[model samples]
Target: MTKADFVRRCRWLIACAVLFASANAWADEKSELKEKALKLNSITGKDPIDGKIKELAKDAENTKKMLKVAAEVAKEKPQPFQYNGAFILARAARELKENEIALEFFNISTQLAMKVKSASKLLESFDGKISLLYEQKKFDEAEKACQELLDLEIDPKFEEAKIIVLEQMIQFKAKQGKIEEALKLTDNLMKLDEGGWYFVRLKGWVLHEAGKYKESAETYLDTIKKLSENKRLKEEEKERWIERTRYILSSVYVDMGQIDQAAEQLQMLLKKKPDHPTYNNDLGYIWADRNMNLDESEKLIRKALEEDRKQRKKEGVEKDKDNAAYLDSLGWVLFKKKQYAEAKKYLLDAVKDEDGQHIEILDHLADVHMALGEKKEAIAVWKKALDTEPASKRDLKRLEEVQKKLKAAEGK
Candidate 1:
């Protein structure tokens, strides 16, 4: 109520107003920058972040515009926009092959995300960083980054991140031919996420990749059992899992030359899902390959090809021709039955189709040519098969066989 008291109070109110106005101005500026950044991010397609940059890079002026806006937003240093902007810049630099700049911004973004206690952003940034490092073939740095990610505080909600990091570690180790070390990490992941069927399957996949066929088969069987008991999956889901695992199991059995075991697995799968084209073709092919039950194998293969055509039609896809794999299976079974002319027709379609020309399919085509005494055609088909890149153990074996065949043909 006194004069001096009122003046002092008015001064304090003025100071408070100034501070509030300053805060509002700062917020307004931050919001504007965020809007600009969001707009830019949206226009950059959902392809790989670097893909956006590569496409954008095709137009230098637009790239310059986005780069400027992103840099300005990054300078804002607000809680989240700063980190988001840094990510954009990093992607752009990465695509531009400015490796040092990209790496620097990636580090900044991840560290900023951590400072804000955002677990999801941190994980995402870690993924981006590791992916960039991997793309650059800097395995050693990526390995170290994986270690750093593992060392972080993993809240239970984000505990899954630990497995992701381990997977990356296993991948690089596997790439470097450290199969034993990769196996150990996969084991660690299996133990950590044993409750999940996917992890158990991962272990079997690693073993299979390492050519441990017997162990892969055993592990897949174990996962099938574990998945069966999981109670989380209803009967239908469990049946689906069993059918798929058994399909994989059959492959390992075949690889180990346990032909009977493989046939049994495929038979079980067919019993459960009679219309599954893959299982039907696999069983038919296995039987024919082993020179057993040729008539039944041909029937199974026909049924598979028919089912596949029906499925494709239902899906609104054109099935004017047979599926390449199914055709190949039918061709093989007919070859086994010494019906070479009929087999040749199907095998020729397979070799000339878009989804066909698979090395094994080509090999089968070549074999059919040889059966028909078309030596020139056989040599040409075998040469084509040899030019195909072998992607698996089976394909590699076919390649080796083709190499021998080529040598024999040359000598003759």
Candidate 2:
């Protein structure tokens, strides 16, 4: 061989040897990283793994460093290591609340997870995506993700996750004011567990909101009966269910204008827990508004206020800044007793604190003002109240009376 050709061959040999050594070193480094990750996974509860994950996520400089390392490693190995690295990065991103980065990582994880047939990992990724979409109020995307989960054919072991997604879909439909769609979805949930109290309660709430009070009351009654028979539940839980059922039934009766029936239900509730302020307030306010049993209404309302104060003091809880309903009840009761000054004070307090412009409170305040001969203020409050009154015959009649009073006050 010629000297020139031999020299060229020697150089080529050296280059190839250097390349092989570098590749071997890179492989060793990657193997070491994998071992370290396994060690991390082996650590027990209260370890620094979660902290390490969080720290890595917040270190944007380190994330770029790791991503570059991942790209290089992926170029060299191009298999399982790439998937593992991507998943680790995704977890870190999620911990940092960098959802866009997390989503990108999740998409890569989904592809890798599917390739490995890692059902749990895939489900986790899908769940993260669905939750992100839901938080963003992207209901269409959230629904799509939910559908993807259902399509995955995940085992019954993940039943709770599946049910959560189903419930989310139902809630989304309900929020969109699609009551019929929500009801249909609820029926599907019921079919999943024929006698599920949770589903029954959900159906009752939806029906009540949709103005199907009779059906709602029946559903609530059935739920109460079923829950009562379930000896497996604790006493506290059973009591909660009973209270919920009675509360719904009472509300339905009130809506139907069956005040006597509502009063009866409230009486039963009070018998169970005589200090239930809501029940006391509602029942007393109903009677006071109708100008019936003025003395008893006053007693009940005062009892409610006393109960609330006692409970707050016992629990070391802060009192609400605005007790508008309680004040309104007190004011109306005092008005019935012809104590105009005392009634005006409480009603005005309610009107001032109720920043949401509560029509009922405004009406009561106007009535008190009229009694106190504050003609201008009474006319203003009455006009404001009338503006918000529902378009019903009874409300229209009240509006007419207010207008007549306003005209008389104006000397028209």
Candidate 3:
């Protein structure tokens, strides 16, 4: 070869050798990582693997190292070990709010479970995947996951898992406004266990979401009747279910603009659990919003706040924070009574609470501001309300009303 060609060949060989050495080094490092993770899993003392993960994951650098080792172990380990390790990692990561990593491990666990034909593990993994997707509002992906689980030829021993998956599918369809599809899924759910009273209640919920108020009310009544006659349920359980269904039926009546029918349900519940914070607050808010029973509404709302404080204390909560929704109810009642200054105080405090950053609460506060002749403040509050995202169709309609209010105030 010529000298220039020989020199170029030598340089190319040197480059290839360096690349080979680097690749080997990386492979050795990866093997060591997998070895370390497998060793960690085998170390047994009061869940040493879990403890190590929790400790190591506290720091960002350590977390990355831990996740790398975990991923390698999950992907390369043998059956049972692979599934268990991946599941543990996914659970820990989810608790730590490392959602993307959690999702990856969950998918790995699911694949391993399917390969091993472990029906229980498959169900658990799918549950995790579906829950995370739902929380992230990835509804399309969640529905697909639910449908995949439903299509699985799972053992009859795991029929309960199938029922749960079917229930979730119904909810998913209902949320998407596919009322007929949701209703059909509910029928399939009911077929899994004919005596499942809860499934009947689920149908009531679907009907309510579909705006079939009369049918929803009828379904809830049937559920309540079934609960009353159910020999299987404990008395306490029966009462709780009946109370809840009655409360739901009240909401249906409210939506149908049958205020008297709604009041009857709340009164029945209050007679049984007079100090229930939610029952008191809901009935009070309904009355106050309609400018009916103002005095009774004020009393009920005050009682709600009192009971809520007591309940929080009993639960051993460190902070005795007032519920923002209850605060809004009280403030609205006061505003209805022309106590604008007092209403503003409670509404301001309501808006300060973490759960109080809602369009409805802001709308109430803006109205109070307007009543107090704080026109600029009202305008500012309304603009903030406009910026807030709506959570429901009702909220969207309320937003339109708020927009019109803003325009009128601005024009004035």
Clashing pairs in model 3, backbone N/Cα/C closer than 3 A:
none
- Per-prediction TM-score: 0.65, 0.57, 0.76
Compose the digit string of candidate 2's lDDT tens values, residues 152-226: 654565554677767766765664567899899898888887766878888887787677778887888888888
Per-candidate local distance difference test: 0.79, 0.73, 0.85
Could you give candidate 1's per-residue lDDT for residues 237-300 as a string of tens digits? 8888887888888999999999999999988877868998888888989999999988888888
Clashes of each: 0, 0, 0
Answer with 1 or 3, whichever has the higher TM-score: 3
State the weakest 10-residue window (summed lDDT) of model 2. 38-47
Question: What alpha-carbon RMSD in Å does predicted model 3 have with respect to the real structure?
Answer: 7.6
Q: Which candidate is the best by TM-score?
A: 3
lDDT of 3 at 391: 71
Residue 178 lDDT, candidate 2, scale 0-100: 76
